[model samples]
Target: MTNITKENFDKAKNFYNFDTLYAPVLPGLKATVMKHQDAITDAFYKELANDEIAAKIVAGRVDQLKATHKVWMEELFNGEYGEAYFNRRYKIGETHVKAKIAPYFVEVITSSLRRSFAQILVAEGAVAVQAALAILDLDAMIIIGAYHEDRMHRMSDVTGMNLNLLETLMSFG
Candidate 1:
């Protein structure tokens, strides 16, 4: 296990507070999200479709998949990042499972956006660092939530795990 010193933990914790020294930097984050939303999503799906695993899983429903995905993407630019924001993300993950999409695609989406965001940030002058951090943190949550849902659906398919199991696992993560 890695040991976390108080100073290090405090630095990490402060990264998400938005009201800290890093507060002003978050608007840049919002700008980045808004500026690249469609391009990022389009690139993500293209990368996803090229992958054998994702292509097979999401073959026939690209439009529906992109529809639900647009909702998830819109939240990033909605300018709210409190408890409600997180709940909505988890809900998106659940929606993906309902639509029969695998959770792994979430990672695919997040990683693709991160790469795109990184390139944009580098060209964004001094404000990009904080924006990049915020992107990293938020994307991690959505990706992991989707991954959790994927696991729940897989378990259910293989072992006949009930709907309750899926909901319970979703809630836990």
Candidate 2:
């Protein structure tokens, strides 16, 4: 698990232009996000239920999923995009990879979330399409960063093992 230090968080925030692009609309978007949480969560799970692989991963865990997802949504809109936020998001990515859930399924879930929020925002006439996209893009970046970080860690482990094996073989020679 990446420690999500302040340095890396700042790097990611800067790389994503989160402060300029996302910070401005975050305040206005919070209420809108909260208002549509249930619909978004339900739709996410509904899609998961339909997918055989995802359904198996979530089987017998519906309530837990809902509760945790709700909390995650709340944190997302809480306007505190700091170390804790990135930490939790990174951990979610690590959890998905460790559980062996396919990355495509995670993409599906994020797409569902983006679609749900876009519909709500557009319907209420509260946010412009461009701002909505920035928000969704920020969300996607964080999620994708988590996945990439986890994969890098796994790759590091494998590389370490391969190097150790090469060293052992050299010793035998």
Instruction: Please name the candidate that would achieve the greatest TM-score relative to the true structure.
Output: 2
Could you give candidate 1's per-residue lDDT for residues 84-139 as a string of tens digits?
66566556655666767665666566666767777777766555655565645564
Can you give the lDDT of residue 60 in candidate 1?
Answer: 90
TM-score of each: 0.61, 0.76
lDDT of 1: 0.61
Off by over 4 Å in 2: 1-12, 123-132, 161-173
**Model 2: colliding residue pairs:** none
Candidate 1 positional error at 120, Å: 1.6
Cα lDDT over the full model 2:
0.70
Cα error, candidate 1, residue 25 (Å) = 3.6
TM-score for predicted model 1 compared with the true structure? 0.61
